[model samples]
Structures are given as structure tokens and as C-alpha cells.
Target: MFIKECAGYELEKEKSNTSEDFFNRSVVTFIDGSEEKTLHVLYVRYFDEFIQEFTPYQQDPILTKDNIQVTFKDIVALVCLIKNPGLRNRKRLYINSKPEFTSYFQDIDFDKLTDVVLSVKQNNKFELRSPLDYIIQTR
Candidate 1:
């Protein structure tokens, strides 16, 4: 699904079913030829979860409407900035990382989530699909 077409995201969708063992696993190969299992980003389905995850301590009232769209690249970039410390750090935390655990998303345009860009594939294998593999155009 194109980022523009996405109405919103669901975080609970990232959960692993009891029957599925190998889910949301990707082998990312860097320029140096190193590859490893990488955990992709998750879609925040519930707005309350998004608020609680991103603004748990804040006293400010959130008024943003539901179904805010966000791109896959920005989500990954947000992960790199908020969650991962460095290259090795990213790989180490590749398995089952959550967006609510990150802090960078709070500082960026997450409030204006509709401006984000990325494509999502709605199959059993790739739901919150990344913009890699020529799936998304470079901005």
C-alpha cells in the first residue's frame, strides 16, 4: 500500500501469532557485505496507544485526528534516530522492536504523521512493508 493511501496503522498487528515462528524477519545487506536479521517497523493501529507510547509523560492535550498516515522510510529513520545508537546497535535490536519504545518519533513530525511516505504490503508475510527494494520512490 502506498503511504498516501494508508489511513492509519495498527501496533497490535505486529504481534506474533502462536502458529507463526518466522515473522517480520528480513536479511539486510549493507555496502560492506554484512547481513543480518532486521526487524521492520510496526504500524500504530490505536491512537490511544500511540499517544501513550509517545506522550506518556506529557501533560499537553493531544487533538490530532485518527488514521494519520506515515511513510515507511520515515518510520525506519525514526527508529535509527530514536532507538538505534549505531550500525551494530541497530542490528542487535533488530528482533521485535516497537515504536512506542523510541524517543525520536516524539521530536519529529510524528504529530503531522500524514506527511510521511512509504509503501505497505498487506500480505501475511509483509504487512508494514518497508520502502526498500525499489518499492518506494526517493524523495
Candidate 2:
């Protein structure tokens, strides 16, 4: 299942764009075998940002369930699920990578033995709706 994780939340693409339409727990597919899901294996797409954004989405039990179709509001509910602990060991932050390393979603990635930050200095910067960006705008 991990091998088939979606790469990221695909906004423009739509399986069922109609309001109140549900697309529970099914892998959104293309005509061919190649699929267009919103998750990526290793979660290495944009490590730090991915971590920050994905953290809130990971612990969501409803959003994480199998084949349950939902609407945009369901996505909001997913954000809410971040704080609710359905499991015995739920927490605000996943605990795997810390020095003690006792976090969930730690194994979400490929279970890489090493926690290395791969760097790629790029010329372009993607605009984001983050607190840092808001601060940069006001100042």
C-alpha cells in the first residue's frame, strides 16, 4: 500500500467535481494504468514543506480511511481530525524522527534508516500561504 501512495493533493484535477459528490477510498485513475492520486511515496517531494503541510493531514483517520467518498467539507473535517486522537498513541506531532523517535507517521516514508535533509538550491521560489509569507508581506 505504501508503494502506491499518492504524490500530493491534486486540486485542478477532479474525479467527481460535482458538489456533495463523494469519492471515498478509491484510487483516482487515468484511462491507462498510471493513476493521478495526491500522495507520494517517501513523502520526499518537498521535504520540509511537505512535512509541515502533510503533518496535519496524516493523523486524520476519516480522510485516511479506505474508499470513502466525501466533499470539500470532508477535507476540512480532515484538518480537524489532526488534533483528535482515535488511536491510543495519537499526538499533535508525529514522534518518529526525534532523538528518542517515538512518533506516528514516522514510518510514513520509506522507513529510511537515516534522516538526511537532501538539499536543492533553486532560482525560483513558489509562493505559499504560510505565516512566513504573510510576515514577509506585512514587513
lDDT of 1 by residue, 1-139 (tens): 2221222222323355542323222222222223333433433222233445554223222232244323332244333322332432354333334544444444444433322322222311222233233222346
Top candidate when judged by lDDT against the true structure: 1
TM-score of each: 0.28, 0.16
For each of the candidates, the C-alpha root-mean-square deviation to the true structure, in angstroms, is 11.0, 17.2
- Candidate no. 1 TM-score: 0.28
Candidate 2 stretches greater than 4 Å from native? 1-7, 13-104, 108-139
lDDT of each: 0.32, 0.22
lDDT of 2 by residue, 24-96 (tens): 2211111112322221111111223333343433332223213442222222211212122231122222222
RMSD of 2: 17.2
